[model samples]
Target: MENGSRISGDRRPQVGVAVFLLKSSSILLGRRLSSVGYGTFALPGGRLEFGESFEECARREVKEETGMDVVRVEILTVVNMVALDGPDPTHFVTIIARAEMADSGQSPANMEPDKCAGWAWYEWAQLPQPLFGPLEDLLKGGFNPFAASRLM
Candidate 1:
């Protein structure tokens, strides 16, 4: 936990981006590849690089994690998970982005095979059970940015 300090005790803060790609009215879900939450179903996203803008990081992470290029990006919501794991724990900034999938037809690329086991597309009403944190938030209307931010 460096800038804006989120961690309380000895726990380190992690930064990650979560993208909600809309295709044919369905959102894409990628299986968690590595162990922080391996085998779990989640959105296409990852940690931010040093000095990177949140928007840029979100776009790059989504492409790398899901192999699908994003044609457009709109900030959906921002979740501060620094205090989610009790008073002293791991922290994370989950930036939810609404993205349009490109027509790249690229397979998941540069992925950590050991981390993610699978990937698929699902309708909002048909998403698999036990949705990951970010996805859960999205479905619960947590990512309603324009309204959430009072922009609309």
Candidate 2:
């Protein structure tokens, strides 16, 4: 087996949890510094830890990446991503969750400078160019965070 493949031959996709942290008409996004999606705008999220629920992962990731406490975390959608073209191809089952800041007046801080450039809020209709692949996939699938949040 290759180094990237599991010894047990398990081929299950890894799970990632992302938050759509909404503040009025804007949502939080950060420029990624990671190799996978470097320079692309993405929501705060990471791999779901063992035994952790989706909501728990969302809150933890948001806090870890942006240093902000989130509330009302709810699952909005799930995306099955298969990237077979890259040098290190991957398959990720990404969970998209919606949340709001616990303190409405609070702003995000860059908790992990190594992972993200910085955090900023952008209006849904005027988002930055070059979104992360999973996020772009989610949007292409017609998953509107604003519309979905309203139904929650």
Q: What is the C-alpha lDDT of each candidate?
A: 0.66, 0.88
TM-score of 2: 0.89
Clashes of each: 3, 0
Model 2 per-residue lDDT tens digits across residues 6-58? 32345578999989988788889999999889999999999999999998999
lDDT of 1 at 36: 55
Instruction: In model 1, state the lDDT of residue 60.
Output: 87
TM-scores of the candidates are 0.74, 0.89
**Predicted structure 1: lDDT:** 0.66
Q: Once model 1 is optimally superposed onto the true structure by TM-score, how far is the C-alpha of residue 79 displaced, in angstroms? A: 1.2
Which parts of model 2 have CA positions greater than 4 angstroms off?
A: 1-11, 149-152
Best lDDT among the predictions, by candidate number: 2
How does residue 102 of candidate 2 score in lDDT?
93
lDDT of each residue in 23-135, candidate 1, tens digit only: 56566777775545546688778888899877788778876666667766777667776444544445688877776666646545536566576677778667787777656
